[model samples]
Target: MSKFKKKAEVKQEIPTSSMPDVVFMLLFFFMVTTEMRKSSIEVKQQIPKAAQLRKLERKTLVANLYIGQPTEAKFGTEEKIQANDAFISTEDIIRWVNEEKSKLAEAEREQLTIAIKGDKDAKRGIIADVETELRKGNARKVLYTAADNSNARKN
Candidate 1:
């Protein structure tokens, strides 16, 4: 009869002491892996398609220049040049380039690159003007951004 009687069983519980550490590790991983652009683009740009494109290795050394028409009606449909968050005139390009260049270390100034992202339908003269300004500013390291054309290669 005594052997037939069963002993009380202890319930096992999960240890949650390491749960917050695991959650924080995941948060830190996402924070470091995700890319967040510092500047907001106000213009609408439909970049031209090209067969070749290269990704910039360091984002901090790159300055983005956007050329396209205003997205809002109040700003008009005329094409404009956007540097960082502001709509800059062609004349401002040189000053903007110099400012961006100055932000980098002297040794890294030569490594700084300007990424020009222009709309497919934007005026060619505008692009030429920007390029001229870049050369004048001695910031000649320029990269033109374009969409990858997958079909072009196949055809």
Candidate 2:
């Protein structure tokens, strides 16, 4: 009984609900807006080992070619050609290399590198063709695709 009831009165109100709904809405929003990562292509080729394998950070061009033994269909069966018959066409190589070179020129990008992905069973001559085309395109750096250790052990 001091002058006017001393301290009036202190009141506190607890939240009834709605907090769970708010949290659920926020979680759903984030889940809906989240971005899904794209899948990367598998590198399918055999690379020759080197004592010094330097890693390159940037790749300006990627050339994909399918080189394999020619198959001839006979009596509903596929007949594989001999080793000497395996080859990649020269015209195709030239076209792909030129395309990559033009891409670099159009983008005005420097420090261009060429990445060649070829079939593992492809002949050396086919790889040589790719290299020659790259040289003509004036590509200074080159990277070759290779099979992983597990895949190598399988073969």
Candidate 3:
């Protein structure tokens, strides 16, 4: 009998046999769990054109207040304020702001930005009223949105 026995063979390769299955599972998880953040605009939004403008750095912190004429004939031709998807009065703004704040995380609540997007033809008086209500809500951080003068896409 030999003094030393033969050593058993050890495999040095990594197993990637389940890589495709794992990848597909992850892809499917994201596709099903993610919700799109687009808001349907029932009001016409022909945003004003500006000579100089800056873009919002963090869009996640913004709560938009859109001012435009209602598309539906029942709403009349007067400029209307749209928060989220509903038409609301100036008196409703404070409550709306609070609601928007509640939806944010604790750290993000203080950094909330109010974006007022009024159409070019929209009256200034209506916009001013919205601002007043926003102030009552203790929301001072504001942004007036406009489109680039030379942009091909108009919104």
Q: Which of the numbered candidates is closest to the native, going by highest lDDT?
A: 1
Single out the weakest 10-residue window by summed lDDT for candidate 2: 76-85
Tell me the spans in candidate 3 whose CA falls farther than 4 Å from its real position.
1-38, 150-155
Q: lDDT (CA) for every model shown?
A: 0.88, 0.52, 0.86
Order the candidates by lDDT, highest first: 1, 3, 2
Score candidate 1 by TM-score against the native: 0.75
Q: lDDT: which is higher, 2 or 3?
A: 3
Instruction: Kindly list the per-residue Cα lDDT of model 1 for residues 1-155, writing each as its tens digit.
Output: 55545333445679999999999999999999987968778888898898767888888899999999988889999999999889999899888988998999999988889999999889999899899989888888888998989677864
RMSD, each candidate, Å?
Answer: 5.5, 12.8, 11.0
lDDT of 3 by residue, 87-125 (tens): 999999999999999999988887889999888888889
Q: What are the runs in model 1 whose C-alpha is more than 4 Å off? A: 1-32
Error of 1 at 101 (Å): 0.8
Q: Taking the tens digit of each residue's C-alpha lDDT, what string does model 2 give over 45-117?
A: 3444333344557643443444443333332221121111233346555555565557676664335665555
Q: What is the lDDT, from 0 to 100, of the residue 96 in candidate 3?
A: 94
